[model samples]
Target: MDRLARRLGLRTDPHIFFWSAGLMVVFLVLLLSFQQPIGDAFGAGREWITTNLGWFFILGVTSWLVFLIWVATSRYGNLRLGKDGDRPAYSNLSWFAMLFAGGIGTVLMFWGVAEPISHFASPPFAGVEPYSVEASQDAMGISLYHLGLHTWAIFTLPGLAFGYFIYRYDLPMRVSSVFYPFLKEKIHGPIGKTIDVFAVLGTLFGVAVSLGLGTSQINAGLTALTGVPDAVWPKVLIITTLTAVATASIVAGLDKGVRRLSNLNILMAVGLMLFVLIAGDTVFLLRQLIESIGIYAGDIVPLSFWNDSMAQFTDEGGWGWQAGWTVFYWAWTVTWAPFMGVFLARISRGRTIRQFVGGVLVAPAAFTLVWFVVFGWSAMEIDGIGGSGGPISAAVADSVPLAMFAFFDQFPAATLVSGIAVVVVALFFATSSDSASLVVDMLCSGDGEAGPVRQRVFWGLSEGLLAASLIVLGGEAGLAALQEVITVIGLPIFLLVFAMMFALIVGLRRERVPKPVEAPARHQTAEPRPAQESPPRAGSQT
Candidate 1:
């Protein structure tokens, strides 16, 4: 415990800890106390935002994505995150694995098969028929857009800003540290404390929401495979089981626990994708992936700008769909920025600015595209196009949790693949819990001290309890309601992210460059002894 404390900076910043943890505790208490009113209020606020501020969500993510790409390709690209001679803390493969696992492993696993199918069944826009060829294309395209570089960019900028400022300027590993270039020493004042505290809230609520969603999906999977009753008890059981596993992983530390689990996640994900590909239509899935990339690239420009404003009057469902899915996704990813950034910054110490962007943003987005294409396209083919007349689409339409298993049932060894999926989901959430605890610990601790192992257990269990509470409170509907609440909490983070961007640019410009040394005057002593002739530029003087 002593060693851990020293590693995490060992000092307690009460303002940050109290504000962050206090806000969350108060929220949890109020939520449970006045569930109906709070849920209603959240629902109302969500509707208003979706109705009015959809454009902001759309433009914000797209602009950030463009901005990060510009940064990666600009003159600052070669800038090392650390000093010039430093090497990366983790190897490239391990780094990417951890990043993928921590950033969106749970999200992708939960939505990979479900999203595409859902979109196909119910087109978000008007004039599009469900389950048509065009709808299928739109489905994959929309799914790609949601999980693309845009989402990763939300995470990448903060990591870049935090990593650059923290390592280059020798600042603390806290969100406020990114403001050091602009705020200078004020980072230690109340303003800095507030920023760090909000970051903690953002991380806590973001992970808590994910845990809620994950428990629901896990329950769905369990009920489908093992005939477990899809009740609050089963969901709670799932949360408890996984939270215990996460506690063990958290105790094991990042390298031994998180890294190992992340590597296993990637391997399992690849295996699942391959199983679907080979078991279904190998050639078709490969073509779908390439074609999906092309479709996504071509449509992203207009799609990013598309706010579905026209559909507001013509179709009520249009705005609701955008709010429920795209806006919610953007908000979720935005909320995840601080946690993701702090976690990424820790492991990405030795990377150059360009490497960090490529690894953190581009690589994971590309991998997501492939994962979607494999599962999504295959599901569409098996159920919609190939004349298989499978129940996958119907199952998805009825319940999202059943989507993957329904797809798996189409192939041989249904039970085996489904079982693998359950394990993957569990482990992914465990990684999330571990990573969230570490990031939140950093925020509250105000540095990279390891802190106490008990804190990890506390956070892991807290997340589970919060998730279980939401489930018991409202079931899947409760999770959806919490999504809106989480988005509301995320608005502050969106502002912080933009501020961090400006600070990063300022800090990079102020970075010190090595000056070249001048060679000494040649043979000064010998030349002085020989001494002396005077010469004029145009004419000699006697």
Candidate 2:
């Protein structure tokens, strides 16, 4: 295996590289060879996880949020992620841009208008009248709940662990290294390798979900603009084209490719958002933004713990909705945790724990909230509360990919704005794919450095292939398959995240408490406290 790798010019951990790639290949084969059975299996898996462990998902993610908050406020917050004199690799603006772009740029674009409006049309709360003002508030708040601090908390914990261990302790840049305190030397053994293998699988499926969504949305944009048909072939073509673009980016490496594209994503996103705010009801959106923040804050506590236990009796489909939306989201985010965690840690060197936690938790989330309000509330207003048979709502129910474009159609310069939205989604797609590929490369290489171009290109293309295959599996069913697979895969990764939290706590405690230096006893003092250098009295001058 080593000789084969060497011959291929691939500098990689044979265990991780071969196993992860092989497993993915087998999965693809199974998916394509017997699409129905594979899809059914994924569906069953999703159902089982959501049914049995839905509350666990809720409680686990909420715990991470609480844990991160405590860590940021605790004494451990002062510890720097790197050496004492080390500073951030990127400036605050660039760092934040990369953070937002890498973390959830594609998802925000895909779901910004869709999710809030969906919630407004069908309020999660039983008594809340759909499309009412309360429903609108609930919609925005729920959107915030899904995309806000909880989501970033999941990313922050693993990122904090990776950064501290890799930079401070000089451990290898692998998910298993986060367990160095517990695994000790065994982090090099099968146990550690298995952890990394799961990390790779989770990352693959997680990023595939984003790639699939981006591709679908891109196809939707093209379909709307050019009268192209939205079908399997276009999505496959979109995935192929974007994957090639991502491969080039990965080959260019992080700073040259991913960073530049990420910055562009932020600029485009902000510009588009500002256009909506200014062109639309600017004052209403501003007011809604403030109110949504308050609504989110007030409801965050109950929403975090709401498992919809009673829905089984009263509302037959309520639990299903929770499972489909909240549980699926938590699971999906958990799958991305390793990818985002590694990416976050890679970019977050030289930051203090408090800074890393606070920035990660707040910055992207704030942007996400503002985005939902600007786009989501705008869509709701245009649709008149409960949609009232509006085109945007129809697109959302019929095809989520078309929802944003449908909303933009209501504004002036719809063509131009829709075109820019497509560019934003495409850039976000490219950034996400390349970022995941880079992270996977790091995981496979064992040392976190860029490997051979062949390796990078291979992972980047593999992500596209997997995404395309899922789309081909059954189109919409393929997309649901992506969600189901992530939800199932997320169970173990979610548990792994908790273990990471424990390991981080132990490591942080050690860092927080300085080791005591042994002083020579009075009877055995060799050179302690010479008479001429005796300590000064409390009140005496030197």
Candidate 3:
């Protein structure tokens, strides 16, 4: 990235793309060539991963919210994320892209069905029966489980870390910045280099899983809607085409590419929900969603600490059940947090710590509660009580796009819905890629100006290539393993972010603030300097 940045006459720093792509290639090669050695090392430790790794997710998010609240109410509240006397580093347009792209748009794109059905088959709730009506509730409940506060809470820390360090402390906002104050002396040496390397390593593997999972489902949607075959050629072709679209957005940079994609995405998502709410069982969904949110309110604290699943997984059949949803989604989202956090930081300038935490971590969970209520509820209602048999279930699972396509096919607005779906997918895909490209550029160029076009093109192509490669290499199981690696990588990223937040909090408060003085006398009485004396200290910026 530094070389490319120099070559392009832009500011230079660590280019993220090379590191990201490098890890992915390395992971793939190990899985293919040295499978035994890799398994012996990584595959050998499932227990430590399930318990401790899971705790990191729980711990990291909880701590982030705590720190954000502390900072917001503390002296840091007056200090925003831009340079002294400069406008906020980003505009509302760019900010919205960085903010919404992670939660409201990219992650939620295909989850309207994929999650509930899988959960219906199995659930995290203690006493829920599998495949029963209650099971369906519990399944949708899990989606709400992950999607709500805790997940977004996971995002807030890194955003805080990045924003505070990059905009305020004159630090690089990269993942490594979080560790700065605590490890500056050591980090400057080989020890620090290792941490930076691991951070980049973890970042690539984590993002790869998200891109791969999301793109695969996107391929499924395209195949279902159009008549494309579910084969390698079609998947590859679609990814390549979509990558170009995302690349175009990246070329436009965050101001154009990323922001436009997010706006379109949020709009498409609203329309989709409206379709489900209006065309399907609106009354029932509203009732259930409301009830579920109430239930979630009561149970969230308990759920956060529910680590008793240790024995149940090995005892009951919940092992396979959990490895699919909670574990996978946690890993994917956890890994993606760093990427999303950096983007979130870039946009969250001029905003308070309170606004940043509330908007990113709180608002989206409220939105997900609606989807589970409306869309997830509608799916359950159609299957259980709406009098449809296996057909609706088959429709939802085998071809969600086709089912929706068929639903709109009955209406006079099939053309419009189809157009929206295509546009939505395109925008959602672009939202994911553009952000990833920016992070890649961040990793590569080290500077913040959307990296470089050629670097973005390379990452855009690599993302498509990785998605296609996973599909061709071993299909769903390969994708599954790839995703597990993402979750596993998240454990360390979580720790790294914790370190960053710790540094931010400590550094922000470490100064020996002079005792507050009374407002100066109306006139400058005695200390008037010769010609040009600056005013007395009022407040700190960094």
Candidate 4:
């Protein structure tokens, strides 16, 4: 096996790479072989987790947000991720661009319009009438809540841990290294390898989910523009085509491929958001942006902790809504933590803890707010304030992937903007795949360096294949299958995240305390003659 790996130019820790890849392959085969039963299992698992463990998910995520806030504001905030005086590798623009592109770019594209409109049509909580003005406010607020600080906070914790350990303590760049404070040298033992294996699986599933969603949205765009049918094959072809692009990007390495594409994604996304804001009711969106931010800030605390226990009995599908939306979002983000954390750590060397947390939590989140207001609020207005059904809301209900294009159809250059939307989603898809592949390679490799081209390509193709298999399971059932898988897998990773928090706290405390220097040993003979070599003068050389 070693000889074969070398011949194929693969540099990896055989244990982690083989175990993680083998398990995924086995699962994929099982999924395809017994589609119905496996799909049903996924659904059942999702229901069980959401019904029983919903509060754990809610509390876990909220705690992450509060913990990050405390870390950012406390005295520990000034600690640099690297050695003292080290500065950030990427500039603010490039850093923010990469963070947005890698972390949430594709998601924002997929859900910016769909989520808000869906919530408007059916508000999550009781007492908010769907399609009413208050419902619209609630919709935007809920959207922001899901995508804002809480979501980024999930990424921030692990990223901070990885960055601190990898850069400051000179630990290996793996999820297991985050627990070095507890595990000590045992990080290289089976326990650490197990943690890394789980990281690989979590990352694989997480990125696969993003790829699946992006493929769906891309196919919907194609269907809108070229009259192509939205079917399993089309989705497969989209995934295949973009996965190839991602493979190429990964081959080119991070700087040449991921960074450039990420910057482009940000530029294009900004252009789209600005177009929506200006072309639509500019005043309404501007007002909505401000009002929605206020609403989100005010309601964030209560909503973060809300589990809908009372509403579950009183209102129909109340817990179902929480399960489908909030819990799902939390679990999804949890799975992505390892991936995003590693990726963020890669780009975040030399930055201060405060800068890292604040940037991860605020900048992308601020853009997310603007994105929701522009696309989401615009879709809501086009869908109408009252219960009168509109095309955008109808599209969201019928086929979520088509929601963005449906909104585009309302504009003048429907085809052109939709085409642009397709390109943006495709770029996001590629960047996400390639970056995730890069991170997974680091996890699989013995050292944290990029491995052979074949290894990168292998992981990249694996993600696409896993996504394709899920999509082929039963179209929408496939998407649901992946969602359920994420939720279930996230429970263990969620516990791992808490352990990481504890380890990070321990590590940070040690970092802040000044270590005492050992005094020179006293001479047994009491010879003090050699102590008088003092400096001659302030300006004179001795």
Kindly provide the TM-score of model 4 when superposed on the true structure, using C-alpha atoms: 0.93
Worst 10 residues of 2 by lDDT: 533-542
lDDT (tens digit, per residue) of candidate 2 on 1-542: 67777777788888789899999999999989998887788888888888788999999999999999999887667667777667798999989988888889999999999998888887878888877887888888889999998888888889998988777776678898888778777777788889999899889988988888889899999999998899999899999999999999999999989999999989999999999999999999989878888998998999999998876787653356788899989998888888898899999998988999989998888888888889989998988874454778788888878899999999999999999999999999999999999999888776666788898899999999998987888665545767787888889999999999999877766553322344212122121121232322211000
- Tens digits of per-residue lDDT, candidate 3, 226-302, equal 76665556666767787888888888887777777777678667878888788876677777866897777776766
Q: Write the per-residue lDDT of candidate 1 for residues 1-542, one digit (tens) a residue.
A: 33444465434565676566667788788888998898888778777777778788889888888878888887667667766667787888999999999889888888898898888878887888877888889999999999988889999989998888777666677898888766667787788888888888777778878887777778887887889987778888888889899889988888888899999988998898888877888988888878998989987887899887776677654475677788899888888899999999999987878889998988999999999999898888877752433587788767777788888888898888888898898889999998888778777765665567866666677777777767666655645676778778777788889888788767666643322233232211221110132211111100
Which of the two candidates, 3 or 4, achieves a greater lDDT against the reference? Answer: 4
| lDDT (10s digit) by residue, model 4, range 262-319 | 9999999999999888899999988887888899898899889888787567756335
Q: How accurate is candidate 1 locally (lDDT)?
A: 0.79
Ranking by TM-score: 2, 4, 1, 3
* Pairs that clash in candidate 4: none
Ranking by lDDT: 2, 4, 1, 3
lDDT of each: 0.79, 0.85, 0.61, 0.85
Candidate 4: C-alpha RMSD after superposition: 7.9
Cα misplacement distance, residue 403 of candidate 3 (Å): 8.7
Where is model 1 more than 4 Å wrong at Cα?
1-11, 386-390, 512-542
Off by over 4 Å in 3: 1-11, 14-25, 28-48, 51-56, 66-78, 83-94, 130-133, 185-193, 313-321, 385-419, 476-479, 511-542
